[model samples]
Target: MPDTPLDLAHLRAFHAVVQAGGFSAAARRLHRTQSAVSHAVRKLETSAKVRLLDRRGREVRLTEAGRRLLSACDLAFATLDAAQEELGQERGRAEGRIRVGATVEFGCSVLMRHIQPFLAAHPGLEMDFHLGHDLLTPLLREEVDLAIDCHDHARADLERTPLFRESYMVACSPGYLASHAIREPEDLARCTVLSLDKAGAWWERFLARFPRTRRPAFGRVVAIDHIRALITAAASGMGVLLAPSYSLQEELARGELVPLFPSIRPHEDRFALYQKTARARLAKHRLLKAYLEALNPAELGA
Candidate 1:
């Protein structure tokens, strides 16, 4: 047979099928019948002269050729979608989903407040928030459109922009502070230190800022994965815990916890992360970045 020519409809159908994982699902997505969808895929395979999918038990799997073609098709579709969004934006409209991943502390303290206003401003835009202990994994896996993280590591395929700076404060139950006679920063050395273990590097950076002799005495070090749990432990007077100021703002206002050694607080750098490929497609990512930038302490009232 003569070499078949490429067809956008065939490509679209194949992409829909691959993404939806079934002919019926793809048909529903494209508003076409299952037979029409199957015929489109057959035409695509005929054009390419290759089997694109394999039957694996009850599921359909992409053949190696299919996987490669699907990747290219995804990139092409993403570019087209981004271009369309840019045109819409130029015409005074914005659209598309913004998936954001954030650390627990940042999510509750900063992110939660801004989301409402952002949605109000962009009526049709969709937002998905994923709160995780680590921001890097989600960004790397394409699980989130963007991530707010505490530090930037060197990664050739990732791009990071410094968003803001925040300080760590040592806080403990008012009762604990009063009972322990901890009137100064140095007195913290005598108490247990509650730490969020997942905050590994950030926690170390915070500690590095302390003077050798004045560093808090390391007693029983308890590590938990969640920042809120650390805050809860500190509120119960179990130990002195270091955390971002915003995360414990409410507790501090309630007089449940007191900032330990305000003078010795350490500052941490905050960054926004996205894959280099995603960064190059800024029009697609700009709204999320703009939303986050507005939430920065200097921009927002904090």
Candidate 2:
């Protein structure tokens, strides 16, 4: 065999000549002169130390050595084409870590369920969820790829995608409901009410909706920082409290807590917040957007 290194041009010309069935057609397909195509085929044969063509009159055929070399060339070129195609797709498609920030209650109650299926569809992706008190600060600092929160503060650099609407529901233990004889929003004024310290805006909206009566007097008013503690207190008949419906689904199913008033639903809010810069560069943001789209209220029951 010749000591020259293999050249892709030579291999391509050889494959094209064999597949195209003649030098003239191969030259036209490759946009090269017939002589140049012939020269490339000759160089390829010399490197392999084999006779690659049998010329019978004006027609040309492949010799035994030529047939074997053509088969090897076919396999090699196919592999190279496949590798290039895959690399191109990786550069253009979405794949990478997406750090998401969410408040604790929203993260556990709603966001976590959607993540598993999203990861299943994209096994190459990784996610880091940062659950905390403040979602907007981390998002503004670009510490996370997306933020899911109830409050939508306007910022010139930030974009928002509204995921779903959720409403607050006043809940109390079955025992409390049975004992208190609370028939209307007015009756809640006489019952103890549990308050979540961090639910500032939500609490304000709740009060604004039910301004017909005075704030409830607490036999024992306890301000809790965590949602789970508030839920626990309501379940134990300690006080009536307001919380998101999604967070209270399990307890309601278990008969631990009953909705305070069937006729009146409290104030509701929509969650609409995303990073502005991230939304513009969609290749990196597609996965996060896809996950949020699946959380629409219509699909929640499914």
Candidate 3:
């Protein structure tokens, strides 16, 4: 260790560099110049008397000391952020930002719908809503305060609150359904299937739910990377979609999309709100947790 104390600003710069992947990106994230960010990291290394990062042009790789220091920085920064939030809360406002991770479909539909009102009510509070298909990585890396996802693992480090079971249905525009004679599962082979993947994995799973001797193969799979885009394509009569019921509520209600084979429901996915066991007791997390738990299932349309 250095004889004198290391500057907190230098440490923060080092952490930001690793988090943002490069000096230039870190500078942008910290609202500082690239040279300034690089200088701070160099200062931090000089103070520690060890090289923390191995720089290669625009890329950077963390040395062993860098990895260790980054972990310490995460804990220290989180504690300070929590303290600041607590101080703000003590001043009688629901202040501080909540980082939320959610699946793209749910984030765009159900979660977004409910959280809007909550955020509107709490004028002082801010939120960072991150939507992705895989939320487990962000949760594990502590990039998110909490996550609403279909991850069902019973990990000791996590506290999970079961939200609801998500069901899927086959959807298409009414005109498309009428134009194409899709009376049975076999008829789906004749229709274009809108899928997130070109492999038509979702359609395969949905078809597996049916107790048929032979599964219908999707003739043409139109791969739309986003659920929202897939829904839009299905609404435009471009193809048939296999989507979660929660995401289809608005379109179904508006008669823009119609469900095919209402009797055949795909497997239900259990979505839960997950928080790190270490931060589960935080006041901001507790407030958001309670608000979500209090939501009506019928209102969510899941």
Q: Pick the candidate with the highest lDDT.
A: 3
Off by over 4 Å in 1: 1-75, 86-92, 184-186, 198-203, 211-216, 273-276, 279-284, 298-302
Per-residue lDDT, model 2, residue 209, is: 60
Q: Which candidate order results from sorting by TM-score in descending order?
A: 3, 1, 2
Q: Is candidate 1 or candidate 3 better by lDDT?
A: 3
Ten contiguous residues with the weakest lDDT in model 2:
276-285
Model 2 ranges with Cα > 4 A deviation: 1-88, 91-93, 198-202, 211-220, 297-302
Tell me the spans in candidate 3 whose CA falls farther than 4 Å from its real position.
132-145, 151-161, 210-213, 274-281, 297-302
Model 3: how large is the Cα RMSD against the reference?
Answer: 3.2
Ordered by lDDT, highest first, the candidates read 3, 1, 2
- Candidate 1 lDDT (Cα, whole model)? 0.74
Worst 10 residues of 3 by lDDT: 293-302
Best by the TM-score measure: 3
Query: What TM-score does structure 3 among the candidates reach?
Result: 0.84
Q: Per-residue lDDT tens digits of candidate 1, residues 1-302?
A: 58878799999998887767678878897999999998999989988999998867547789999988977886787688778887778877687777888877777777787679778888768889998777776665455777777767578656676576776777899899888888865565677778766334435655687777655456567787678888998898898888877778789889999887777657665656554453447564776666666565632224
Better of 2 and 3 by TM-score: 3
